[model samples]
Target: MNQPASAIEILDTTLRDGEQTHGVSFSPAEKTNIGKALLERVRVDRIEVASARVSRGEIEAVSGIIDWARGAGLADRVEVLGFVDHGKSVDWILKSGGRVINLLAKGSEKHCRHQLGKTLGEHLNDLRANIELAREKGLAVNLYLEDWSNGYRDSRGFVYRLMDGLADTGVGHFMLPDTLGVMTPEQVTAAMTDMIRRFPHLKFDFHPHNDYGLATANVIAAVQAGAAAVHCTINCLGERAGNASLAEVAVNLRDQLGLNPRIDETHLVQVGELVEHFSGKRTAHNAPIVGEDVFTQTAGIHADGDHKASLYHTRLSPERFARSRRYALGKLAGKASLLKNLERLDISLSEENQHKVLQRVIELGDSKKAITSDDLPFIIAEVLEGKDYTHVELLSCTVTSSLDLQSTASIRVRLQDEVLTAAGSGNGGFDAFTGALAKILKKKGLALPRLVDFEVRIPKGGRSDALTECIITWACETGEVRTRGVHYNQVFAAINATLRVLNLQIQGSLQQSRSIDPTA
Candidate 1:
């Protein structure tokens, strides 16, 4: 039989430590937004937002967060990192309207000797004085033993002296950070166990960085060894390799350690994306829980297995993270993959037609191109219209554009066994092509749809002849339609996309004409 799950408090430091990441400084507005999302939406236990006395902008960001947190009655959950400068950091935090100070103390002897040039007694005295000032000023305190891993490893006596000196300071939590991210899981577990056993009356929060890529694993070991809380950041934003990812830590704590962390897992991706945008860092597509492609399965066997009683499913389903599972369409896709995509679009096809469409999809996938769901309708039309719809066809086209000159196009097209050619000049190549096509269509008493948007993407390692995909969105009388086309030249890609749209309209017109009653 399984045991009842343990509970762990989540302290998020995306703003404090995360801001330490190279070239990342969240604006006051961005920090406030992320802080709100972290507390109100994702509902972590606490959030450490910024360091004390960084700048006026830092003060404003922390003050704004305080305003928001106060209105939501969660002011105590907001925290800030502070220095042990004999109440200098405490005064700065108070000016920012912050209620909690995570006071940073030297956890290693080297930090004390080399950096502060203070003996153990002198450092402990300064730390106590700072804590006393914060307490007298009516601010809650949480002391951070920065580099606690090294302290415990090299000089446990110094660590013990610091803890013992502050034992009765009425601190809310004692945060132990593997500050340099240099602790193994076993070392973390052992250290946490020893600390919890020695200071059984105090609360402990384990903070881990990802320099070793073991922060998540080590955090779990700490929690399992009886730490009351664990600290993390959104999207693993921090100095160097970053901190343990909040999403990964939360989910793993729940599933691996059977520890019920206080986090709204569904909003994990929302926070991840919001942080990425503000920090100007792109999250990897394969990043667990919050990545774009984590939920996409691209194997034929996997899709088929899923269809056959969901054999490939797991507890980490996309729905658990407020996302849906996707069966990728490519050369590795099976008929089941096609069916899954078609089902999403609510379109059904006969078995014979399905086979033909799948073959075409495979051929297109072999070209090292991405096929989006929006491309499905165009593919369906082309495969079914094979050698049948002579409504419109581009027989030939020539376009030229030069600097400081009018761009020109000449095109020959066939409409229902009648061939016509036209020439036109415009501002650019695609515009010229459109102008020629418009004139030719006007002669046939046909009107084109309104082009609302045009997007283009070229794969990396580009050359003049590299394949480019053009996606065009049109607003027609009935509804909006999207089409895509790939070509070695960009203007030609747009032209091919335009041709697909024309063919679709012609087919629609033909269908409507046939639907009318002959007697009427």
Candidate 2:
């Protein structure tokens, strides 16, 4: 595709339309934080903060954002949604310190007659009155033609009449919303092209919904058809399915359509995380750009292909989004995938050992078991030795805890003929166990990596004693390592994984330093 000379403007509505997702709400501080992130970090051109007169809390939320935007010299770039309520919404907007208002007006004849119970002339007069009132209040107005796509299709005369009436209103922009998300990309392209040609001087913004999973596609189509700006929500959050996903749209424009998008691509995942934290709406693992599995290569053939050449990948590079590519070992994992895993652990395996280990990995995967890099050492020992390997072993462990009592742990570890014991107390039994291990490593002048992440997953609808899988990611000076443990007890699995991570860090660091400096 031929690249465009300039990037399109991105107006993020995560704080407004995104909040409309069922059971999602952001507190004032969260709203302010997200506003800052979207503007400064994500580098979006503008943001729609909230709707006017929604609630006292919403009023305060917009106020907080306005105050912050003013200090950051971004007040002019911030916007709020308002209704044509004869100065009611304008008054709330002014009091909240918002300078721009996205005025919502009836677009289609059906909405005018059925929803507002007004004739075409009456609806135009009411909108004109509201626009005049807002102008008098010193507020910039951008008009939202709610259901505009439907208006263009089913009621072209009514839509053209409304636009002709507003031609002299000095509105900043005309926002066309596919409110029902019913338009295909072809429809969007044709409608947008016609509107831009009909109203050559009017700036157009395209807002798309995701009910049919084509919001991103429709957004690209509109941009191609001459939209000056595109509206998106972080994490694709909105009513019903969602709005166009900001991350997905931005990436698509840059890579697929060859349109320059002025976005800080590295901050894409961070924006998704902030939105997820505030909105409490989780992003699915397979969601386009910011999803957990989007960058993870799951099939072994794909992993091998990636290793040889990145032919299996799309233009969406994980590194551009502040994420690393990951290869998931499963029933489909091949030799290339196992080699990559071994390389991360600084372990070398013969071709014979590699084939044997690959067979076992596939068997475990076929049985629905997940394997991590940390499990490879034990697997190697078991498969290679054909018997239990006694290189390092846990001799004994004792844990004690009670309500309102300090938790304590004592552990004995054996390395061949040498045995070491350590004891400690902590806020919880698992913490106590980790504390004891930390003390033992300290005695050996070893520094363990800090545990940066911990997650526990228990199958749904399982019994109380159902197996729990604990995954932990530890960050050391060298790099990050992940380990997994499974047991019926969640606490036990976490503790076990923590211990293994610490041990691996200590041994790996010691070996590296020794190789570098023989005197040590």
Candidate 3:
């Protein structure tokens, strides 16, 4: 492999090749959003957004992207895929306001001979014609060798001759694609090195598919072998196993190979999510760099190591990508792991209390799945506040949820020495209970926290009597707050969690008053 270069260019094809994933289609607005995100936010070098003449909607999407790109001074960074069909593709591209055209040409001898039924010389004439037409139309041009890997392997001379012939054509980039994703890293290195050695003046970009699942590795090899750029799709969206993931390839170029890729690492996850949302592709939680669970520490040893000595830490810290590391609370959590979470929550516990909490966490982990930080206050309240801290208590809650009927709740609460009862109804039992609680809290001049998100889950292999954990995220005046409640009944679990939050707020209010007037 050649010595590393300063930086490699990234061409994102999430809107073009990525949209080809089976059952994935983006609306015109979605296309514009992704295109803008790739160029403006993620800061990829270039983006191939659509194929020429695909559809009216596609044209509309391209027009929208071009309009934004022009206003943002990024019009030149956008590209469209075209074919060597005389001037039709170029005309289509010009109509869509595309500035760069990636012209698709036959790369493999088999494709050229069998698919196109044309001689190599005849194909070159058409390619040259198309390039000249695009240039005449004021469009920059790149060439996509649809199966360049196979072409180099089977007919090296044919591949060289094509480059030798077109070296003077003033094409902006020669995009070499492992269209079938069949090349190993070794093959990619050797072929790309040979291509660079022979055509030293030509700009080359490597595009790898994931059929062999070595697309990222092959991309690294190609870059090391002196390819100027690499093409990728977000969330690895493409046909078959997909293309190399833009997130994986980009980070590898930076972190592993020590080359500058002009992507904003912080925006990778955001762009991946946008593509996933619009494309309807579910990203694997364990996917490198952009997966949901990639930043979560599951093992107690790993968490403890990080806390003690930063042992498990690497340069690939989550903070670098605008994400926070998570020490998952589960069966695998140690005291150190629990400490990390408590420190984050700004809650301190005695050593003995920490041990008790750790044991409860482990027990719950064995039975259930995720337990968030919000659950800790309830556990602490149960263990420590047996009598004190009962600012407001739910004396009784009776909810009726039945088929084809609105859920109703009758709740009685004790605030200090007084008892208040209220009845309310909603489409769900939890909503009904919250409504009743709101009515009673209104009488006490206390308002409920704004519910932001509610998530519920049961234990693994949950039996009929398994405990239900209800986690609620609240938007408080200070910030966001999360609380958890586990109970046999789901609605009761939510109520228990809500009560903990209410008590916390009430206690906080009392502390504030006390601080203002110590004499009182």
Candidate 4:
């Protein structure tokens, strides 16, 4: 039988170290919201909310959090970062009703010599005095050995000397930070094991940064080396690269390491979305666990493997994190992927029709176009219409726009060769086009859905002919749906997306009415 992995505690520091990211600052209200969400929703074991005496705003933010945590009866679980400054930091912590402080201390001799201009003995004495003062002031202290990794590498003897001096200072924990994020997993294991051997009685916490994109890996190493807690931030928000990401760390610890953390995996993506919105930093589409495309398989072979036996997947299933796997259609899509896409759209194609549609889809994909499920009917209508079936078609559209000039669009559409044209004008060309479309639909006694949202994405590598992808969402009496369009011009993309939505709506209404009364 295999031995089970050890459990490690999680200490999230998004509000403190994470806020240190350049050009990122959370308002007091924002900090309070994030604190509540992290504690009550995400359920990390502890949260380092802020630093002491940073600013009046920070003080208020920590104070508010302390009040909230107190009401929730979790006051002790909240912590604040402080420094050894003759009890000034202690005073700030006490004033803010913060009971726990991660006291900042020099871990390396160079920091002591250059930053404080103090000898090893002098620094130890100062720390002792500060610890005694903190104890007298009723503050629980956790020592942060700033730059401890560098200390272990450069001056191991001095590092041990400082730890030995403060070993019995009634400190609650020793937080070893990779302050410069320079340690590899091997180094972390070696240094952490040495520290554990030297101070067997002291509880150790590990804080890692992401300057090298190895913070999560280092966190795992720390746990393996017997760290009691590891610090993380939501979305890896911190100075420079970032700190270890909470979602990645939590899931990895649970699934890969077989460690149990009291985190609700289902809420991981929701929390990431909330933070991304509040921080005004959009999460990249490819971000692991919480990105739009992480669960979407775009390659046909991968989709086929997934359909067969989930052969292309890892242990991280999308459903485990409240997400569903998606099959994307493009040049890379195979027959299995196309069948899956058709299944999602509730459309059945004959063997011959499937090949024709697949060919067209591949041709479009070769041009770097993205086809959505809503585009299936239009493709079928164009390919199979008049030959094997009668279907709806857009006959012609006239659009005009000029600055301070009358913008107009006249559209003529044909349903089984019955033609209808409508004209309208508005402030912009697309707007006028939509107005004319609505007019035509109303005159033909067709009910049009309302457009709820519109978004345009301009591809990178700017050029006049660069492809623009437009997505539109529509809401109707029956339901809501989304459609995507691509074109060289932004306006053209929008127009295409709008037309797709309209086309889908017409097809859906026709099918529903036919289903209600087949003879009619």
Candidate 5:
């Protein structure tokens, strides 16, 4: 019988199998950073850092990871994948300072007979020789039965023979991979259960691929059927459809199966982002746990439920992952959604004005998707035209740009009663505008807030003339604020967004002064 609630080990293969992702490669420094984060911060049980003898770069990456892991008293937890080239792979691993080697062996008869052109006996001899050499050198060994899923399905005898030959070899973990990601959850459960029942003493780990989008689900099945550990990759970076997502697998194991995985929940998204940045792969906005929009409430009703009584809450709270819940404001926004966003911004409005703002937001959503909360002030200012949010405004501006040449911006702006002219140059038009704007603000003994994130996009399927929307995030004393601007030209859009930030800053200062002064 399978245990109901036991600890499951997580073996992250992002640096090894994950590098097989198309056009994705991590440098030695990147690998070291990721490895440190995984073992020190995210706290996965084990990490497979690289493949042996791949390159001089691979050696450097593995050696760096091993050096750190050893100093941290986690040398045995770091693993490197190696081939069945007798002593060569073992020697390479030792050269890289790795203590554990995940040896790749043909699991399926077809792979053995066709790929390696070796019979079962010959392959067993090679695997035993490699295992012996690893044991003699004081290196831990884990065997990967590559394509174990099909091997068990097509020819159980071959799998039985392979396991029989290596059953007493003192291997740490026998990792079974669904190499083509062709197993359904039912199949995984049956195979994993049978393997456990048959072997009884050997530790088995299930490695799943996401070609069928069943990697996480298959992990659940494998765990329920007694897999001691499961393999995953950060951000699901792997060949074909990728491997099981480390975040998804860890969360599901805890929530669904009552299993404890050695994962630090708060750092899941942090590590995912690190991997995303280094791998140059953009995770989908809706990807679970680590996606940008995963914690955002898009539906108005959902926000309402959350606002009234936390009806829409779950154990998967964003706070658990060091993130905050966001209510998206768009055409689907309602009174509750507006209230939620208003609450976040510490802004209070009359019911009538709130209604007005909601209507405008919906109207904008008809053309745009979701208006960021940073954009709310602009919408509110426009909806209540009586409000004085525009304490500063740009009177006129001209920007010029040419390829391979610095861009220049000449701007004339009215700061209260004074008109100022400033010119500046930069690598791009927006940069030039900021340079010029900085000079103007410097005159007033104020500096613009540091820019944090800038994103520009257009309506999906829109033409070249389609309006460009630029949302700029800035670091302020309170925290962060985002301002949005829309224009046909992308540069102008960014400039408009920047102008909005300045107006808001000036307006806030005036309001603060008024509150402090007895007479003005």
Candidate 6:
């Protein structure tokens, strides 16, 4: 293998090729904003904003991008895809104020024979004419050997003939594309080495697709094989499985190949978000570098290892991308996981309270699936205030509600020594549950206190299955008392809060009776 270059130029084609993604079309304004962010913030070396003669909107978009790029002294860095229709594509690009055109030509004999029905010599003549026209119009040219991977493999002579025909056309870069994403790393290494060795004076850029999920790997192979630059798209947006992800390509080029790319690490996720929003396509949560959960530790053992010795840490730290590490709270949570989150929130808990809180987290996780650090305070508050009382136990309860119909509830509860069943109807599920509890209390010559206030909340950015926290305040004869509960179901959260109140009220009444008469 040939030695890698010191640096590589990244040409982000998200706006042009990425728009080919299914159901994705960016408005001119959206394209302008993304182009600005990619060049100004993310600092990519080049951007391909549109294809020549696609639409009036594309012309407007390219004009906007080119205008801004020129003012920023980066006009030549912005490119537009152009076809080989003599001077038509060159004129379209000129009308859009574009200074660079990536001229597309067939690389394979099959494509030239079947798609265009022209010989390689005829195709070369058309390409030379287009290149001459572009140069005359003061536009730099880059030729895309479309499907060069298959071309090199099947008909090396056709590829050599095409190259020999245009070797002196003054095309700045010959971009080689794995258009169908069929080449393995070994194949890429061999072909890129051959292309570089044969055409030692020419610069090459590798454009890869992800149909086989090897775009990033193939990029490594190409870069190591002495390619000068590479082509990629943001969030891997493109036709079919999409192009190589810009984030993965940039990072791997730097870390795996020891080459520098003009990319601001912090702004990677920022641009990824911009494309993800404009394209209306959601990236995978586990996508490298820019994924939502890439930096999160869900395993208790991993958190523990990191806390003790940074054992589970890697160079791919979240801080590198302007994100923080989070220790997930769930059934897998251990004391170390709880401690890590507590330390993040700057909270100090005694060992006993910490144990209690950890247990509550595990119990809640059984239904909530995952709990974020934002939910930690709720669990702490609930566990700290709850008493170890066996005065009342909720055995089984069922609450049902329907549209335009009164809700109904049936409950079996054990109060001190008696197990009683009661049924009631009310306005909603929680209201019906309270009505049933009230019936059982009425039989014991007791009444529930007046409800002063009730509040419910979930963690920030919480999913639908996140834990629900319910806090209820009741007014008794003495004063107001508050109780809190955490559960996956809002109704059950309220019921748990109510049970705490009942336990407190029963304890208070018993204490008063003992004070009034020693042996009644």
Candidate closest to the true structure, highest TM-score:
5
**Best model per lDDT:** 5
RMSD of each: 5.1, 3.5, 4.0, 4.1, 2.0, 10.5
Q: For residues 1-520, what per-residue lDDT tens digits would candidate 3 score against the true structure?
A: 5545456889999899998899999999999999999998899999999999999999999999999999999999999999988899999989988899999988888789999999889999999999999999999999988898999999988888788778898899999999999999999988998888888888999999999899999998998888888999999999999999999998888888888888899999988988887887889889999998998888899998999899988988899889999888889888888888899877889998998888888987998656766666655666676443687889988999999999999999997688999999998999999999999899878988999979787877999899998888899876898887889999999998898888878877876798899875
Per-residue alpha-carbon lDDT of model 5 for 47-133, expressed as tens digits?
999989999999999999999999999989999998998689899999988899999999999999999999999999999999999
lDDT of 1 by residue, 336-440 (tens): 998888997777899999999999888889986577665676678779876434478889999999999999999999877899999989999999999999999
Candidate 3 weakest lDDT stretch, 10 residues: 379-388
- List the candidate 4 regions with Cα displacement exceeding 4 Å: 1-6, 386-454, 463-465, 473-480, 487-492
Q: Kindly give the stretch of ten consecutive residues in candidate 6 with the minimal lDDT sum.
A: 369-378
Give the C-alpha lDDT of model 4: 0.85
lDDT of 5: 0.92
The TM-scores, one per candidate, come to 0.81, 0.87, 0.84, 0.86, 0.95, 0.75
Angstrom error of the Cα, residue 208, model 4: value is 1.3
Worst 10 residues of 2 by lDDT: 385-394
- lDDT by residue (tens digit), candidate 4, 55-91: 9999999999999999999899999998878899999
Candidate 3 regions exceeding 4 Å error are 1-5, 385-443, 446-448, 451-473, 482-520
Off by over 4 Å in 6: 1-5, 387-520
In candidate 4 the C-alpha lDDT for residue 4 amounts to: 38
Candidate 5 vs. true structure, TM-score: 0.95
Where does model 1 exceed 4 Å of error?
Answer: 1-6, 387-520
lDDT of 6 by residue, 283-398 (tens): 88899999988988888899999889989888788888898888889988888899999998677999999999999999989886447675576577679867355577999999
Report residue 161 deviation for candidate 2 (angstroms). Answer: 2.5
